[model samples]
Target: MKSSTFKYSMLTVGIAASLGIVSTANAAESAAASTPTIDNVATATYKIGAIAQTPVQSNKVTVNITQSAAFSLTAKNDDGNATDDYNRSAIVTPKGRVAFNHTLTNSGNVEDTYTLSLAQGGTIPGSTQDASSYDLAATNVTYTVYNADGTVKKATTVTGTDFQNTNIVLKPNEHADILISAKTVGNVGGNSQNLTLSAASTFFTNSDTTKATLTNINNSITKVPVFKITSKVSSTLNLNDPSSKVTYTITVRNDETASYAANANNIIVFNGLPEGLRLADQPNLSVSNNATIVPGNEGKGSSSADDSVRVTLLNLEPGQEATITFDVQKDQNETLTNPKNVINHASVSLDLGENQVIYDSTDGTDPKQNTNVFYPAGDDSEVTDGTTNTTTGSDSAAPLVANQRALSIVSPTKKEIPTSTTESTQVTHSVILSNTGKEVEGDKPGEVKFTITPNANNKVTVVTGSVELIYDADNNPNTPNAVYTITRDVNGDNDLSTAVPKNGAPPWTGMAPNSIVTITYKVESNKAVIDTTETTTVSLVLGGQDVPTLGERIAKNTTTVKGLKLVKEQALNENCAASTTLTFTQADVAASPGNCIVYKITAFNDFSNADARFTFNDLVINDTTARFNNKAQVLTTSTSPAFTIRLAEVADANVLPTDNTYGATASSTAVSGTVTNLAPQKYAAMVFAVKINPDGTTTP
Candidate 1:
């Protein structure tokens, strides 16, 4: 065999060098460095015969390395986490910033650049996505990535899913830490949101064959303190007492939700009493455990010069409650409109700082436009402890009546009237109308109505009214101060102004405050249910200019109307109808036998119902001459045929059945008739003529 010049050619082949890592790398950890080529050649020299022959060698084998791309991303925690992890946790303040720490590593043999992105409720590619307790949407969320070393890579903060094409360049086996920040909006400090951060390798990004990416998650929850306020008040002021004060009750409570019930300290409650009102007494305050009230300069009491009241509570815990009650009286010096109202507004500061207000009038109300409620007089049912209670809006208390316009009746008398059975009697009730509120002027004056509610029977009803108005120009209750007296007749009108002439100026339309109006009522009360209230409502108007609200309910006198009673009786005549000259008399008279004797029977119908359809229908009547049917005893009675009962006509407004003929033959022994449709309060008669067949006690 010829071993002539058997030499290996110089070989050059591309080969992969020491790969850094097959797994992902994170911040503070090394990654696979640049791709290094393996260059080596195999050399062999063999002489032909161990002599000085020419050396031959095979071509040297060579290898070159190619780049392998790899990178990783991880989320870090603020609680001193030693190494980066896949998940991070944090608590976010509402309307404030919450940042999540993260790290990115280029775990590859070659240097690589990366692009960062943040996604909410998103999934990692090529893996099964998962959900947490609270999955928050990345939409509407904004974040900015800042270098952990205080270096600003991208000056612009990115929002939502758009990463703005920002890039992060890193050396092989190098890593970088970044902070992702976001602000939570409109959350009441009780909810949570999950976020994800992803780092894509730009070296082989979107490559046709190979791609590398890392994704990690962060969970954030909202934490803050919240509270609820409640307020309540009575609709009307207590008028019986001279103090004339209105009371209000207010309560403050921590939020009911567990996450929102954070501890609060040094709570301050301020209630600004409205104009035309003054504090009357000391305020009453009560609280739960771990809380106490701090009094203001008024010492839990009220001052005439103080326009507002303040109370402070210390160390109010979650779900704890505190209550306060105060009274306000009308200021006599403050002059206001006649039918106006006063409103009180309140605010609650969490830590005795006005800027840290937890509940206020403008909490849920419109900022651009302020709206308040005005409750009508005598309809004050909307006062809730807090604005979230009985009423809808916050800040304003239920409207309290501030008008000094009031009227009432005094010296009511009770009487009974006696009358005959057939006659109608009249009853009267008199009272002095006293004005205790503001002046009742001509242009803005209202009327005190005198109403007469009947007893549901037609016996007694309201007929008219007579008013004797006495005007006092000087606004005094003394007798001599009333300078003018006018009388007017109000016929059948109710709860309206009296039609009286004020020196021929139509009617007197004005009355000063504390004046007296003497009005006499002509009402008929039949039954015993005394309709005592004779005042009208507060809605009043004068020539449609100024609407007035003036009257308070006042008691009126009691009247009773007696019912009618009638009785009638008829006696036996003892004689025939022929010999007696009197028509209907209870007297003894003689009559000849064979004379005409008559018998009568009447059908009377009297329906007393108030219904007009009440009547007597299909009425039938019958009469017999049985007294003359027997044989005559000695000077006693007449025998057969002495008297015959037949249909005979008798004078009756409501005629007998069928044209007054009683429905019987002329010579019949009995009489019968039918009266159809006999109305109420009417009567019908059935009569018969008898032939005294020469049969009378004396004649026979």
Candidate 2:
């Protein structure tokens, strides 16, 4: 089949010349061609003609076309680094903030839109499995998007989900920076939080919808423990009392959730005693949670100025506390030039280890953990400082005195009761005698004795068999030390017939400074309404001389009048006899709003007395809603007994009395007249009427 064959070929390239669309080779040569170009069209026509012995044919074609779409995106840190771009980890304190910087670039040949957001779930790097996860709440994070030239584009405080919903467009080779700032929640410590960031392009596609341009880039923050030291004293020092002890308590606290440890050694606590104070005993040390204490130097001598106590602790975990308590006493030989100006002071120091990690917000530099802290720093005006890391707490005591004796007495029963007509009335009184003075010298207890004198009109039939006595320990009357003796005045005379030796002698010893003795006795009153006051005075004789300041300590016993005792009660119902007694509480009258009240008054005389008269006046009805019936009735025994009852008179209808209704005034006239010559053991009754207004207009 060797036959002559005609062959023709034609080549054409569709070119959008005005749009800068060129051949693949030219496009690769010019970097500007990567940028998108606007709409433009160009046409190229080709024709070929061939002539031979037979027939020859050729074909040419031209076509118009549009550029294909393309998209690309890249995300990096603000430094333009491609890997390990953002802050990987940071040590922060609770309620502290950290900032992360990132950049989003459109590296494709065409313009593109990108969405940036933070990933919510991920494990924090270099953190335990139980560490807390990052919080993506809008309230905790703030973000700002900036243009390539550093101009702010948008600033907002929106959550990751909200930011992802926004579309950010960029041209080819254009980039934008984003600053994501976040703050740790309060009280979140001992754990790390991971913040993952993501950037996705609208035109980009991935098999997993959760991932796009950038994903799972973790930025983490951790909260470290904080340490603080404090101290306190028990009480004020007493210079005159050598046996007095003052306790000092020093405390160390790890106020965070992060556990802290030292290298090769535990935390050391040191305290130095102030001048004029000596350590009394070993310190009692206690640790909370998982920790152990090692005792160091205990205060051994009182003469050295450097006398101090030390304790070491291991494995002080988060939220743990430790305390040290020790007692100090005033040195008797170390006399102060100004006794009143003496100060007993102590100090404590805490050694944070060399490797302790402290997270502070003020400075970015990580300082060495090896630091010493003194409680009551130099600024504390109450404490004097020997050094920067040493604090001194002080307390002052009053000046000493020689042989100071002060005495006082108190009677629990000082009121008087009247004598009875048929028989004699007996009354008992309790008197407390105390030595309110400084310590006495020479070991001689203060001398204290009692003298009783009865009223001549009502002499004592018998001064009781004997009086009771008790010693008061620690000023508590209920807590008695031992029983003693009480001198009795057998007859109604000024002299005390019952005698006991004084000055730490038999039956009256142990009455030292700040000591108390209680005495109790009984007396009888013979005549009614007479001088029945059985006055008893306690005298204190110290160092063979009377304690002049022992003021007249007197207690009297008298009787109350035996005539009538008046009692009044209110009732909601008109039938005063059937109504229950008013309890005088809100709940008792809450249910009964409309008051149709009746007041029942009773005069009771239990004791027999001659020529007795009972009168009732100024019976105040304080309820503003009450309108009295202006009438009253009296019922009494003894047919011939004289009694009268009348309405309570008011002087003014507009001026209100102190305790009466607004429209009522104080009255001087008697509401019920006197009952004269009433028999013994007899009672009288009276009733008054009142009504409550329904309109509430009378309410005060």
Candidate 3:
């Protein structure tokens, strides 16, 4: 042991020196004496069967992808079969065939056994070689299968030896086979389905000699063909008119496991008259197993690798499922040359030019039905004979006696009215049509209408009857002007042209021959006119038959004249000496032009037994400066009461003392005019201050 450790260190140092690992010999000597010690030796045991030292590696992660579509299945004892394998989810279709697909690949370095199978419902266990070291069981992982509607059809756990495929191995760079199939349920046109597949495990294992174990290995479930539809409706084709024939080219494909049948006989059936017509007989049906039908006849018309053809189908498919076309000529029954009644298949006729004829398909039972009466009138004309030859001279007196009738307005004798008042007033007028010429039973009530226009002063409205009139009133009440129109409201038709014919034509036949109507209008006065002359018009119309005589009635208009009256008059009170006379007056005026006179007259006098009296005098007469001559010689007297006292004119001598207020008291008189009294009485008085003058002259 003379220094075994040192000797080993020296050897190491020598090697390091040779390799140029140390600076000098002295450093090497120091390192040689030192004892070599190792830490963590107990934990440094090397893994057996490992070949080479691993280099420092960067962390990396790789993803594995698998795509698939199919149904679900259960585990079975088959050669290298995966337990609880779900090829796909679940699919439900409405019609026809359905298809499924899938893909699988090795996602790891070691070989693995990937099993795919489907079951209605249940769970299967997985297996691993080393039971102590590796676990392939998902530890009660539940596998679920869902229906097309997402309903869970079945659920099971993977427990036993192998949940995936047992004893099956998959090598690196290798992928498994995925199978998809198209299955049919029933029927032809419509189909729908859904399928889903999901993985429920996180562990993987190898059944090799090494019995390796892998963690974090993920299994996935995929949904395949989530939804599918099988049936489709085809376009419609007309079979009557050759032009109606529709060339339908449809690309039909099926993924069903069985061979699909698409023929004229196998297609859906739709039987009925097309739009308003039908075929004369059952059309012939000729076809090629893989060829398209033509327009004229049903036969192998065209062929192509595309499997697309133009078929002229005599019969249409129900809901237009299969596309078929034909020349669709109008059935023999549609041809005009075909008689209304003819023998069955009697040379079905079609009208060709140059008088050429085609036969009709009329049964023998209807012999008369094949007549020309039912045929279209093509440039055919007919004539009727009437008596137009007659003598114009009246050879004998009263040779022919005929009866005629006429109408007249009997009820409303007047039509016009005067609108003078400020308030809107309603004027009613009615017309009675009487058969003045002759009376007949069940006389149809002739329609009567009245039309009115609204004016700034008034608005016209129909109060009792309709306002629709049809006539040619050329300012003529009987007719309407060409620019304006009137008409009867037959069916309430307000179209004037329909009621009263346009282009100078007679009215429609709906209206009665003769009618009479009296129209009345109520007009409102303007807001600013308190009293004014107002004229209103009401048009009366009498048909030619109603008023056979000309100028029977003149268009009369009534004018209303009104005057505004002073409703009330008042006077201000004023004091006057008992010996003086006073008068009150105002200028009377008229608002309208008329031969009227305005007089200055005194109103009421409140003082009778006072010191004052009321009188009116003229200062100038006919441009002559005359003395103030009293006209009203009223005297104040103590015997009279304090009420209104009337003034007397100069012509009345009984109550006169021309200039004197006979007994008015000075302290109690109110006056408005100049006056004089013989004696003074201290009484209260009130007088009207009014003056009357001739020739436009007055005293101040």
lDDT of 2 by residue, 54-78 (tens): 1111111111111222222222333
Q: Per-residue lDDT for 1-700 in model 3, tens only?
A: 0000001111344575686543221101112222111100000001101211111111111110111111111211122322123222222121222233332334334444434433222222232111111122312234443333445545444532334442223354343322223222221111122222222111132212121221111111211111000111111233334544212112111112112111122221111222222222333323433334432222111321121223332222111122222212233333323221111111112222223221221122324222122122221111111111111100001100122433333333222222222222333333333333332311223322222323234322333233333233222475543322344355432232233334675544432333332333233322223223333323323333332321112132323321111111122122223333322222111111111111122211111222122111111111001221222111234322122232222321112223323231212222222212211111112222222222222221
Q: How accurate is candidate 2 locally (lDDT)?
A: 0.39
What tens digits encode model 1's per-residue C-alpha lDDT throughout 1-700? 0000001111111112132223223233222232222211111111111121112221221111222244556565654443434443365444444676666655445656777766655432222332223222333333333443545444344454455344777765566666665644443344455666666665555431133455666656554444445554543564445376656665565544344345667776766665555566554444444454443333222444444567665455665556666776655555323313444555565532212233444233424221111111121122322222322222334445544455555666554432211123344556566666565633232344444344444444444433334455454555343322223325433333433544544355566666665555455433322223222211122233222332324444545322111111111223544345424211111233434433344443333333233343344443332334331221112433233333333345334323444453332233345555555455555444443333332223
TM-score of each: 0.32, 0.26, 0.18
Top TM-score: which candidate number?
1
lDDT of 3 at 644: 27
Task: List all candidate RMSDs to the true structure.
Answer: 45.0, 37.0, 49.5
Scored by lDDT, the top model is 1
Candidate 1, superposed: residue stretches over 4 Å from native: 1-72, 77-96, 105-112, 119-163, 169-175, 184-195, 202-211, 218-226, 232-249, 258-269, 274-276, 280-304, 310-345, 348-700
Task: Tell me the TM-score of model 1.
Answer: 0.32
Choose 1 or 2, whichever is better by TM-score.
1
**Model 3 poorest 10 in a row by lDDT:** 39-48
